[model samples]
Target: MGRFNFFVAFIFGFGLYFYFDQSCYSYFHKEASSITKSTASGHILAYLITLIPLLITVLFLKKKEINVLEAVGLSGSLTKGFGFAFLCTLPLLVAFSVKFSLNTGLSLNTIIINTISSAFFEEIIYRAFLFGILYRCTRLGFLPSVFLGSLLFGVAHLYQATDFVEILEVFAITFLGSVFFCWIYAEWNFNLWTAIFLHCLMNLYWLIFNVDDSAIGGMYANIFRFLSFFIAIGITIFYKRRNKISLEVTKTTFCIKPKDR
Candidate 1:
């Protein structure tokens, strides 16, 4: 019954978020603009409306005696999360600095809207609410749990693509990115901050430097991106081993959980 409720909650929450995010964002943005003069504030407020489902889910979990923070992967160490993310993404900072010039005209609004709000909200919505609940709270396995959200995440980035080939490239890269974020989120003991900071720092570097116009980067950009990926994965494994902690996502839990089996 608990798992059933969780699954239902996920469906409802995800649907609500999607509807408002896609359809009602403009309306809320206008309403928010009336209240707050800043466009960034309006965007933030509109994004906040999309989190109604998450708020409701947290309340629902409270009724079930679930630790809301732990369930959503928010109870992890913020410091460790930021520190590890910085180390893992250092390659991007270095590579971009060497290959691309910094944007002298970058604005505070861009930082708030693009990097901070984007990373934080997207992680909570797509990852914590959509993927986390299904994988952690319900009986769904890693693959099944991540598929829909990752697909949606990929599809959401299609706006950046101008042509069919670019569309394909964007979708593939974002989908793979969604999967990588999920893996690290689970591996880091469901500490969402790790993924959040990683996402933020990556976006920050990309925005601060003229790396590429789209998520699908050029060959040189991708080479360093892949290097960052390898560094993150390597460090995760090394720390898990050092701490004698079992990895959360393993072959046994890939398709279905042991209890389900």
Candidate 2:
């Protein structure tokens, strides 16, 4: 629940700042170059909104009052978080098959924008906030959490899309891709950094491939849509099984000697 609290609060802050303060949207409205001076102010201003929430989350984790580190983790847990991110890179490696056109593929500046800023915003909001929150109270089980989290993650992208159909397709792709990322978080008992890196790579891969927008899901698209689903599910099931085994093993080691009531 602490994870959820941190996430929800951050979102509340971001929403208030974005809508009322008019950060990025304001830049666009004014036709300002966000990559440049005046627009940079908006970006900084936007991130500032979540300052409190991010700080609170770190403090809460630092206090050792919750199992957040165990439930999900930080960058410090290299083996669990970083390793998992590396492993998950495989599916994406295969999926992003589109040949890069030197002229067409992403520029270095775009990489920085996409990988650093955009990725940070997306992960902090969807994975950290949505999954971290809902997983706390509802024991409705794992798949359900993945499904719901993915749905929320996808739906949020609607704000950026133009039409209904495109938005829906984006949602579906996001949901599927998100489930795999979420599986890592849950599987390793909540490794947040792994989720973050995997997410960044997922987006980076798509951008590098210069994937046709329509191929995300449309007639004659190159995407092996059905295959990706199966692969994601297969990985998820394997991890879930492995996690259950690890949990059972650890239960014996942490036995309680009852405290004085």
Candidate 3:
């Protein structure tokens, strides 16, 4: 019953946020820009509206006697999350630095709106709320828990591409990226900051350098990105082995765990 309530609440809250964010964001941004006389402020105000769904989820959690911070994976060690993410994404930083020149025109507004806000808010909504509650609270398996959120995450990036082929590529990449983020989130003891920092640093590096206009980059760009992927996986495996911690996502739990049910 608790899991059912949580699932319904999150879906409803996220649905509401998604609708408003998609349909009304421009209006809110325009209104906010008129008041603050700053486009960045407008963007910030629009992004802050994401908190409505977060607060809604928190209310449901409170009713269930769950600690909101821990449940949402916010109580984890920020230092560890940021540190590991930085180490794992070193390849992207180095590769982009060598291959692409610095984007001199990059502004603070771009960093705040594109990298920081997108990373933080998307992770909280998609990974923590959508995937986390489904998997942890409901005991749904990894594949099932991550599928819907990842699908939406992928679809959300379709705006970057016009043609069908490019759209497919963008969707595939972002969908896999979503799954990877969710995997690390679970592996790191459900600490969402890990995913958040990783997403932010990667996006920041991409934005800082003139890598590619869209998420789908050239062959060289993707090469380094894949290297970073392998590095993250390798490091995670090593860490788990050294600490004797079993992986959270395993074959036995790939689908609904009969025992857990």
Root-mean-square deviation of every model = 2.0, 6.9, 2.1
How accurate locally is residue 219 in candidate 3, as Cα lDDT from 0 to 100?
96
Compare candidates 1 and 2 on lDDT and give the better one.
Answer: 1
Clashing residue pairs in candidate 1 (N, C-alpha, C atoms within 3 angstroms): none
Query: How much lDDT does candidate 3 score?
Result: 0.86
lDDT of 1 at 109: 81
lDDT for each residue of candidate 1 in 42-105, tens digit (9 for 90 to 100): 9899988867766676557433666877777788999999999999999889999999998888
Per-residue lDDT tens digits of candidate 3, residues 193-231? 999999999999999999989999999989888787788
Better of 2 and 3 by lDDT: 3
Off by over 4 Å in 1: 2-6, 61-65
lDDT of 3 at 249: 90
Which of the numbered candidates is closest to the native, going by highest TM-score? 1
Q: Give the TM-score (vs. native) of candidate 3.
A: 0.91
TM-score of 1: 0.93
Q: What is the lDDT of residue 60 in candidate 1?
A: 71
For each candidate, how many residue pairs have backbone atoms clashing (under 3 Å)? 0, 6, 0
